[model samples]
Structures are given as structure tokens and as C-alpha cells.
Target: MDFKLTEEQQMLQETAARLVRDAYGFEQREAFCQRETGFSAEFWQQLAELGLTSVPFAEQYGGFAGGGVETLLIMTELGRGLCLEPYLPSVIHAGGLIEQLGSEAQKEALLPRVAAGELQLAVALEEAQSHYQLHDVLTRAEAVEGGWRLNGRKSVVIAGHSAGLILVSARTDGQQHDESGISLFLIDPKSDGVRSRSFPTMDGRKACELYLEDAFVSGAALLGEVGQALPALRYQQGRAVAAQCAEAVGSMEAACTFTLDYLKTRQQFGQVIGKFQALQHRMVDMRIELDQATSMAMLAACVADQPDSVERSRALAAAKFIIVRAARFIADQGIQLHGGIGLTWEYMLSHHAKHLLMVARQFGDDDHHLQAFSALLDVA
Candidate 1:
């Protein structure tokens, strides 16, 4: 596949880079993290105003109907700045699910608002015991008179504290760990029987633990067909994984830049450390990893919007596995090259390193994807 960016894609990348550079200074990012929402509402609105948030949705809902390449462009820029916005959860994950599965009325009521940045959404899929398994849902949703009544706890729900709506997965039919009976429900976070405990992640983003006790959602809240939500959930998650790989690539790029700059200026013995052949070789290794990751990220983006198939799944898993390993290597090497300064909170490289580490853990760690790839290795 061709790797060249089109004229429009280049323009999108430039716009995103410029906006992030102008708005996401280190001090500004720290200030945003101090807020209740853990990100800049103003910057999020700026993304909406600039049409970045609407890149992947249908034009009828005020979106650009752009595809995976567009998402790659935007997410890479966001990763560079380490922007703390909920774009992944609100726009990409939840919005994609709605567009993919919502009824006409549901899409009409939600997508426009989401495209306009009027609504924020979070997804709750991980339980205490689930680890990284998406199908290990223990949350139960029993059919009630007009809708479903849900009861369960969701752990480490990214951006759950500030979401107006949350998409939750629960077992409505089969036993735990069975993929056949899982269902998706859109729930109002402020409704009765729901509670949230908010906290900051190691990388400065906000997250929450959610509890549901008889949480009621209308029948309209069901996304896709009953007991058939697993396929869509897994499919959309692949898209998310691809986008995250792009983000990690951006972060890796930043880390490499920071380390190279440090090596050039920092004196050790009689000369700058960058002059040392050993350090130079290490930097070269980091660059090689970064390039590999960038290629894999692009490959993942190219396939993110394709129809569901074993090939798609295998490609995504491979992308994620390679990217995760690259991220971990870059993060560790960046810190090691920088020494004590890299660990300081005041420095941007430290934050980038932390973000890279977090990226490895999200979606799935390196091992998780390796196993997934192994399982689908013979599909071709």
C-alpha cells in the first residue's frame, strides 16, 4: 500500500499539529489536568470548531465522513501534544458504536450532538476480574418492563467521571466469558442507581470506577441486536486499537526528539554525550524502532475501517503488538538516555514516557496481542 499522504491529508495533519503546538504547552496541559474534567474544555471545543471531532462520522450528522486515514492524522497529532481530551472515548469509540449500530432515530438524536461536541461519552467494558478479556463480562442486564435493569461494577473506565452517557456491556443471556450473550446499553451516568469514583491516571488523564445497582435504561438504549453486540464491540475496538497505535507512534516520536536534543547539549566528561559513539548508536536504535512503529501504525490505520474479517483482526493484532513493544522500548530508552532529568515532573519527556507506558497497557499489552495474533495466524 502507498504511504504517501494526499494533499488534503497533509493539510489535516498540519492543522492538527499547529493547533496542538499553539494550545498544548506543558504548563497549559498541567493546568488542564488540575481541572475536574482533567482536560481543556476550551481546547475540545476548538477541535469541534475546527471539525476534527467530526472527521469519522456521517455527513448527515454534521460530520466529514472521513475514514481511517483521517483518524490517523488527527490522533497522531494529539499524541504528540499528549492532549488529555476524551477524544478517543467520546468521539472515536462511542460515536463509532452509535453510527454502526444505532437506529435511525438513535443516530439522529445522538450523532449530531456528539459531532458538535455537545455530548461526551465513555465506555465501560472492563470488570475487576476481566483483565484484558473483552468477553469476560460479568455485568448483568435483566429485561424490565420498558428497558433493562443493570447491576455490576466497571473498573478503570477511562473518562467515565465526566461522561454524560456511558456505554456498558453486560451479559444478558449466557454465562460469564461467553461471547454469545453479551449486550450493549447506553446509560445516563446521573440516573438513579449509578455512582462513580473519579481518579487521575499515571499519565495525567482522568478515569473512574463505575457502579451500577439496578440502573435502568430505556429499550432505545440497546445498541445493535440483542446478544449480537460482541461482533460490533470487537470490531470498533479494533478501530480504537489502530488509532491508539498512531497515538503511541506520535508519543514515541516526541520521546526520540527529546532524547536526541538532550544528548546534543548535555556534557559528559570532555564532550557532549551525543558525540559518544555508544550514545549515538542507542539513539539510532530508538529511531529505527520509531520508524517501524510508524509504518505499523499506518498499516493499522489503513485497515481500521475495513469490513470485519480474520485478516482484519490479525492485522490489527499484529499492529498493536509491534506498536506496544516499540512504545515500551522508546519509553525505557528515552528515560535511560536522559537520566534523572527524564524522571522529573517539570520536563515534557517524562510525561511523554509515562504516556507511552500507559499506551502499552491500554487496549491490550504486548503479550495480549501476541496471543491474539497467534490465534489468527493461519486465517490466510
Candidate 2:
């Protein structure tokens, strides 16, 4: 199959790259992380003004109707900059769910504002015990007077502290771990009975632990149909895994670049470290891992928006597994090559390494995806 980017894709990639390069300098990123929101509000507005926020939605909602490739391009640039914005959680993951599962009225009410960046969103599907299992929902949503009362806790909600709305998953019926009874709800984070404890993640992004004690949402807040959100959740998460792989590739690229630069300039006993045969071999291994990661990222992007099927799921699992392993290798090797300077807070390489490490933990870890891929294998 052809692997060339279309002219429009190329333009989108360049626009995203230039925007990130100009706006996300190392010191500037540090300042952004210091803010209460843990990201640059001005840069978020820039994304809205430049229409980058609308890249994935339908045109009727003031978006480009772009798909996986477009998302990959934007996320790669974001990753390279070590940006702390909640683009993956807010725009890609939550917004895509609304587009896929929301009713016409829900869409008409929410999509435009989200696309315009007037509102931010987050997903709250993970429980403390769920690990990466989307179907292991224990949060309960019981039918009430005019809506539902939610009761349970959501853990590690990325950007949940600042989101205007949170798309939450709860067990509306059936037993825990059963796939048939899960449901989705759109909840106002500031509503009564909702509490959040916010903190900074290792990668400098903000996240929160959400507690819902009799948190009531109106009937209109339900997304898709009751007791049937698992399929869509799995599919959208597959897309997210694809986007994340691309982001990892970008971080790996930055890490590799920093290591190579350090080897060339840092003097050793008598010469630059780049001249050392042993170090040169290590650098070559880092590059090889990066190239393999890039290829897997591309493969993931290609299938990210495809119709759901066993093949699509298997491909995504394989891509994520490979990318995760590669990211860990590159992160370790990058820091090793940089020596003491790599661990310093002032260096961008250290930050990139942290981001790479965090990427391995999100969505599903390397071992998780490896098991998933193994389960999907054809054994005929």
C-alpha cells in the first residue's frame, strides 16, 4: 500500500509543526505547567483561533471532518513540544465519543462549542480496580425521578479538574465485568455531589480523582443507548491508542535528536563522545528503535478510523505494543547517553523522557496490548 501523505495532509502537518515550534519553547512550557490549569490558556485559544481544535469534527459543527491521519499529525506535534494541553482527552477522546454516541439534540448543543474550544471535556471511565479494562465498570447509575443518580469513584481522570463536562461510564445494569450493562453519561463537573482532587502527572499534565455521591444527571445527559456503550467505547479507545502511538513516535524522535546532539557536542576524555565506537553503536540502536516505532505509529494511524472489526482491533493492539516497547527503550537510552545532564529539570530531554515513560502507562501498557494481540491471533 502507498504510504505518501496527500498535499493537504502535508500542509496540515506543517501548520501544526510550525504552530508548536513557535509557541512551545522549553521555558514557556515550564511556565505553562506552573499555571493552575497546568497548561497555556493562551495557546489553547490559539488552537481555537487557528481552527486546529476543529480538525476532527464534522463541517456542520465548524470542523474539517478530518480522520485518524489528521489527528496523528496534530498529536505528533503536540507530543514533540511536550505540551501539557488536554487535546487527547478533551478533543480527540471525548469529542469523538459525543460525535459517535450523542443524539441529534446533544450534538447540536455540544459539538459546536467543543469544536470552537469554548468548552473542554474529559472521560471518566477508569476505576481504581479497572486498570485498563473499559468494561470493568463498577460506578453505578440508578434511575431517579427525572434522571440518574451516580455513585462511585473515578480514578486518574486526565484533565478532569478543568473540564466543563465529563463523559462518564457507569454500570447501569448487569454485574461488574459484564460487557452488556455499561452506559455513558455527560455530567457537569461542578454539579452538586461531585468532588475532584486535582494534581500534576509525571508528564506535567493535570489530572484528577473524581468522586460522585448521588451526583444526579438529567435524562437528557445520557449518551447513546443505555446498557450498550461498550462497543463504541472500545472502538474510540482503539482510535485513541492509535493517536497515542503517533504521539510516542514524536517524543521518541525528540529524545533521539537530543541524544545525538549531546554526543556530538559533549567532550569526553580527549574528544566528543560521538567519536567513541561504543557510544556510536548505542546511538544507532536508539535510531533503529525510533524508526521501528515510526513505522508502527503509521500503521496504527492507517487503521484508526476504519470500521470496527477483529482485524482492526488486532492491528491496533500490535501497533500499541510495539510502540510502547520502543518508547521505553528510546527513553532509557536517551537518558543514558545524556548522562548527568539528562536527569536535570532544566533540560528538555529529561522532560521528553518523562513524557515517553508516561506514554507507556496510558490507555493500555505494553503488557496489556501484548496480551490483547495474543488473544486475537488466528490459530488455525
Candidate 3:
């Protein structure tokens, strides 16, 4: 398998890395976190100018026609900088869904605005009872006189408060746990009978719990088929999991690099900690974990690019399992090896660690992915 990236891909990766290094410093990130939106409009505009917001879409939709590898590169760079932008929710998830499943009219109205940073979207899929089950939707979308009426609650909606639009998942046909009958709807966040309560997440990001009480939407709001959206939704989930693994790899890389640099400079027992054989071994282990996790992330991206669902599921689950374990290990060791300063809010490692831990639970946690991987193998 060829792991080499194209020149265009390399340039995209470099550009994203440079942008984050220059614009997402600790102070800038802190300021963004303090804001209610949890992101900077200026930074988002900068990303749009760089053509990043359009990476995952087709050229017809004003995008670069990029794929999983492109998404992986962008997300890894964003993770390295601890960027709090809603790129994952807006671009990779909701925007990608629209590009894949939206009608011609819907794409014409939405994708361009999303690429221009004029519209941000968040996905409301998770319910309180649905831990890591993608199809466990309790939210209901019933056929009404004009279109559809939504009545249910969605929890932990990423970037929900700031999103101008939301893509909500609801059961339109079958049972709660059934894969069929799940449908997605494009919703106006400020629509009547819709309420959202926003809060800060562990990684200093914003999320919301949405309560929809007989909220109404036109028939045009329905995406894809009414009761056969599971496949498209699963495709989106695969891409999201791959992107997340890439981000975790980036976070682990940063943590390990910071710890290694500190060990080389910080004096302990009148000598640099790097000189201590014991500390050197620990750093080597951290470096190994980082490399392994990076490989797994690449594998995930490649597998996600495959046209086969079984291949995608098995590979993504395996990649995420490795990423979740390595992220926790790398983050914990980074703080422990750095001594007390690593825990201080002033140190970026502390924040990176927090962010990495948060990523573990974003799409699914270690146990979830582990179980998924095992199940896939069993079926195989």
C-alpha cells in the first residue's frame, strides 16, 4: 500500500499546520474558549479563505473534492493546535451528510453557504438512552398535514448553540433500536417549539441539549429516504471516527513532543531528566505509542475510503480502539513526566491532555470500539 501523499495533499497539510501554529496560540485559544460561541469568527473566516471548509465536498458544491485523507490531515493539525472550531460538527458531519444525501435544491442552498462560513450546522443524533448506539433514536418525526412534526429530545449536541442549522435524527418508521425507520431532518435552530440549553464541555467546547416540542418542518427538510437513512448515516459515522482517530494521533504527538522537550531541558538531581535511563525508557514508550497510534489512524482513513461497509466498520473500530488507549496513555504520561507544571492551566500540555481525553468519548469510547471490533471479527 502506498502511504505517500500527493503534492496537493502535502501542501494542504502544511498550510493547515502553519495556520494553526500562527493563529491558535494559547492566548488565542483561551480567548476563544471564554466566548459564548467557543470559536472565533475571524478564525473561521480565515479557514474558509484557505478553502478548508470545502475539503470534504465535491467541486460541484464549491469544495476541493477531497476525501478521508484530506479530512485526517486537517483534523490532525486542528488537534495539534487544540482548535475549538466547529469543523468536525459542521464540515465533516453535517455538511458532508448534506453533500451525500441532500436534494439538488438543498445542496444549492446549503453547501455553498457552509463552504463560505456563512452557515454552521450541528448534528443532533444522540439521545440520553443511546450510549454509543447510532441507531438508538427515541426522537420521533411524525407525518403532519403540511410536512413533519418533531417531538423528542437530543442530548450532547456538539456546537448546538452556535449552529444556524441542525441535522436531527429521528425515528420515522420502526422501533427505537431498529436500524430502519431512522430519518434525518434539516432544522432551523430557532424554530418555534424548539429549545436548546447550552453548556461547556470538558475540553472547553460548547454543547447543547435540544428539546423539540412539536417542532414543524417542511417536507423539503427531509434528507435522503424517509425510512432508509441508516446506510448514509453509517457512512458519515465512519468518516467521523476516522477523523477523530487522526485528531487523537495529533494530540498524542503533541503531548509526547512536549514531554520530551521538557525532559531534555528540565534539571532533576542536578542533571537533565532526559539523561536518566528510567525517564528515557518512559519517553521511548510514549514515542512508540505515538507512532503506533499514527499508523492506526492512517489505516482508519484508508479503510474509510474503501467502498465496502464491512471493511470500513472493522478497520475503523480497530483504529479507534488503538487511538483511545494510546491517547490516554500518552496524555497521562505527559502530565506525570512533566511534574507539577503539567497540571497547571498555564501549560498547554494540560489542555491537550484534557482534549485528548475528551476525544476518547466523542464518537465512542474505548470499550465501545473494542466491543465493535470484537463483534466484527466474530462475524468474520
TM-score of 3: 0.98
Clashing pairs in 2: none
Q: Cα RMSDs of all predictions?
A: 0.8, 1.0, 1.0
**Residues 1-380, model 2: lDDT tens digits:** 88789999999999989999999999999999999999988999998998899999999998999988999999999889888888899899999899999999999899999999999999999999998999998899999999999999999999999999999999999999999999999999999999999998998898999999999999999999999999999999988898889888888888999999999999979899999999999999999988988888888888999999888999999999888899989889888989989989999998988898899999999899998888888631
Error of 1 at 205 (Å): 0.3
Off by over 4 Å in 2: 378-380
Clashes of each: 0, 0, 0
- Model 1 earns a TM-score of 0.99
C-alpha-based local distance difference test score of model 1: 0.93
Give the C-alpha miss distance for residue 373 in model 1, angstroms.
0.4
TM-score of each: 0.99, 0.99, 0.98
Q: Model 1, which residues run further than 4 Å from truth?
A: none
- Model 1 per-residue lDDT tens digits across residues 80-195: 99999999988999999999989999999999999999999999989999988989999999999999999999999999999999999999999998989999999999999999
Residue pairs that clash (backbone atoms under 3 angstroms), model 3: none
Candidate 1: residue pairs that collide? none
